[model samples]
Target: MSAQKVAVITGSGDGLGKGIAKRLAKDGFAIVLSDINPDTLKATAAEFQADGVNVASFQGNVAKREDQFALVQHAVDTFGRVDVFVNNAGIEDVMALEDVTEADFDRVFDVNVKSVLFGTQAAAAQMKKQGGGSVYKIINACSIAGHESYDLLGVYCASKHAVRSLTVTAAKELAKHQITVNAYCPGVAATKMWDRIDAEMGKYMNTQPGEAFEKFSAGILMGRPQVPEDVAALVHYLASEDSDYMTGQALLIDGGMVFR
Candidate 1:
């Protein structure tokens, strides 16, 4: 094995994924940044390049099986090995249960649930081939919603709940191969996802802008809304040897918002 590690992060064009990519880069991992958006992908690559990070970008949709496999292949081809895989690409929907369209439900679940399943499947193959065990890690992007259901986010919550299930199941099954699987559940962050959540909630509940976001943030025992870095810090630990003993655990990093 080479002294340098390689990490592939999905939805890494912006927001939390970008944060994890940067953190892993700082940890001395050559990174493969994957996203569906080409422009953001280029921009993020430029940002990392400016910072002198070992990074590359892959434009792909995580919901597609071929893209998921190609992402892992890209990392191996570029960096020579895959050390970490972060399933962070996800989408959210804000609607009453009765109002959710079939299309909306599928879109949410496809990215949040199916992506994790296939992404992990493809990455695990590489890890197993690379001589598995503590040599590689699989990290899922779970959420506070995964632990506690929220109103108007029924489909999104359920999808994340599925993530929790996959995290545990994958951890148990992959342990024999020496590959550890875990998840970090993040609270509301000021990312575009939360902005959309807040905006949609405002339209649904007839509230002013930022009102919905504030209401949720106020509930956090941490006294502030979470940042991408907060979530990335936990993920960094999970990706490193420090968390090798921990597996199949969906950890809550929501600042005491949800006690689990």
Candidate 2:
């Protein structure tokens, strides 16, 4: 068994997921990066290898339960044990409630909600099998919408809400196994995902590109749009021993966007 901790981050090919993987690698964990995009996954793995980080890459859609299980298995096969598993793969749906179709609802929920549930199940099972004395963590990627609803994002918000609920339930169920499940809800980060949201909102609001992003970002109490590093810092805490006593909580790390 390797002495270094191991963390598996899904959707880590880019954006916030990639940022989290980098931070964990810097924290001395052997990283297992998983993503549905093969090219992006391979590129990210190469980047980490160049940086001399102990890393592995797996390409899979986390929305599938079997794929989630395989991801955990890959982590264990590559690195000895899985200390932290991040359910960070999610999709954004920007459309009015009435405009949402059944496919849209299913696509969003399957990736955002179902992935978290099964990912936690797989990680918790592995953690339990690893036995006692080790503190295992299942950190989920939630959003500010999880705590509050937003226009044109009803289904996405609902999916995040489901993620929060699963986080709490998994925490309780896995407590006896020394596995802590918690979630981090981030606000308006300057990522490619936000770029897409901005574009969609532009069409809905009849505004130019970047206008919607500016408007949404202006509401941030911190007076600045969120950066990936900010969210990564919170995830780092949750992955560390410092947050061992904390679980069953959907923490809002949105720079004062949503209170409580």
Index of the highest-TM-score prediction: 2
Clashes of 2: 0
Model 1 regions lying over 4 Å from their true place: 132-134
TM-score of each: 0.98, 0.99
- Judging by lDDT against the true structure, name the best candidate: 2
CA-RMSD of model 1: 1.0
For 176-256, candidate 2 gives per-residue lDDT tens digits of 888999999999999999999999988789999999999888888899988888999999999999999999988888777
What is the C-alpha lDDT profile of model 1 across 179-218, one tens digit per residue? 9999999988989999999999999899999999999999
RMSD of 2: 0.7
What lDDT does model 1 reach? 0.92
Clash pairs, candidate 1, are 133-178
